[model samples]
Target: MRPFYCLTFICLSFAAAAQGVDPAITERPPSAAQLPGVDAPPGPAPRPTPPAARPSPAPSAESSSPLPDKDPASRVERLDALFADLKRASTSATADRTVDKIQAEWAASGSATADLMLIWAGEAVTDKRNGAAFDFLDQAILMKPDFAEAWNRRATLNYIASDYGKSLADIERTLQLEPRHFGALMGLGAILEATDRKAQALEAYVRVLEIYPTLKGAQDAVGRLSEELAGQRI
Candidate 1:
């Protein structure tokens, strides 16, 4: 009976071995549903990113430049103001100072308006400010090449400055443009006088007097030349 029992145990052991513990099963990789949360701990609220810095604007070419303050219009207005003040200046020194101020302002102001510049040039000549007068008148001529008044003013200034050759050239231009320009005629007379062409100066003065009998300086010039001609027995 014991042998039979042993045989039965052996049979059972054999059956278990035959079933050969199925090879150990391996686990499959986890699917998306079983994996760790993609939206897990909403990490400490993300810090707000600062905005990028913007580049500074480049400077403008015009704004960066240091230019003279006076333009043509401004120069005209300033010169007119200076002339107005000159009328009130008490002494020669004060007048000279005003003239200097105007010239300096003009220099700083660049080109001036043609008409105003001509007026300023005439004022300079009246004050015997030859250098300033010539500068202003020359500028006027340059600005308006065919401007008869400008040419005439320049001629008068040149004559006063003893620049007779330039004066003659300018006067010729003036006469070419306006034959009846009395100022130019007077300039021609003055130039002749300086060159000792007394006869020619007298003729020129007489012509001017004929045109405008009440001309301020021509009467004196005529009287002086008449006496000079008599003295020379011509």
Candidate 2:
């Protein structure tokens, strides 16, 4: 999987700030995961086939559905209530250590909205529960089809699960939604690199550098591609 530079920077900064130190004072650890060979056991099985797209739920004929009402007040109130319930359910001392706690919190809170689903998806990815993560991201996409981060994350999960075709599709969608999404561009670069599409991969890395000039991975990618192109010319 491609390393997420933004996430790494944020995590490192947070760690440094926690210790009352300047983030620049510490050397950031290398961020790449060792890409194992084909001999390694494959990642988790592909997620179950997704359900057919269902029509969106429409407001009942009787009630004024929040769908038509663009008022933020009611939506904010519901969000507040949902967060309060989630906070209450997540208060168990042992919850931090147990997946059951996450499951219970999700189950108990009827108001766990699409935003919460995205949060859960992130946790699922960290836990290596790719199947669960896909489900949560799917829900998030259904709720907000235009959410670029959700699509980018789902693409990453697909990449990890070795579904490159699906990963490519999702990453494309992510880029279409957010042209400057460095993560998606990086993912596309990695996928193209793996497929031996060096020129395309170079373009992707260049695009990422355009958005995030300090991204080390993109710099490294450019160097690698330059070397490859030089070798071809020679």
Candidate 3:
């Protein structure tokens, strides 16, 4: 969710090898429902890490100052328009562009300092120092408490560490700030599935599909959960 400042953003690959983190910990199903026509390959899982000991900060614990000194009303208006367009996009290409633009805006903290913290957090993740990455991201959130990307990335780190409870907590924060975050919604679905909350997971995936119809992961999850639930009912 961290905006790609200088054209560099968090890989979001979920399972990049360089990070020694398995994407599966984030969502570990045999990916099938192909993206368009091609099957999306599974990324390697990273070595298992224990959950963090400390409790996650409450959703209300974010720094009091959640915005930059300069008002970002115009940017908010632009993003809202793009989101509206995304919802109505008739073509895949148009939807893709709209998604990209929306995500870019979501990543921007409008503060260089906060952005740098995000970059550092990413680097920590790459180095396989997830604990360190969490610290960096916590600071980022403190500096820009309203930055959804910071909460999103931190949630990702908790997911990677297999701390589902913490991950879910942070995810709640992310969604609170950005309800339209399909990525967080997908993540919520994965965590729900992993925790044996199948019905909730299905609902989460369904929501993601409603937002981004072409998202292959959500498609696959929805199919899998639907089949599982149907078999149970039968």
Best by lDDT: 3
Clashing pairs in 3: 3-107, 21-46, 22-45, 22-46
lDDT of 3 by residue, 81-104 (tens): 987786687766676667666665
Residue lDDT tens for model 1, 37-131: 00111333122355699985677986574433535566557757776665566654564455345433422213336544554544454355656
**Which residue runs does candidate 3 get wrong by more than 4 Å?**
1-70, 90-93
Winner by lDDT between candidate 3 and candidate 2: 3
Model 2, total clashes? 0
Clashing residue pairs in candidate 2 are: none
Tens-digit lDDT string for candidate 2 (50-120): 57999876667765555422445653454345434433443323211221222222222223365456555
Candidate 1 achieves a global lDDT of: 0.47
- C-alpha displacement of 60 in model 3, angstroms? 40
Error of 1 at 136 (Å): 3.1
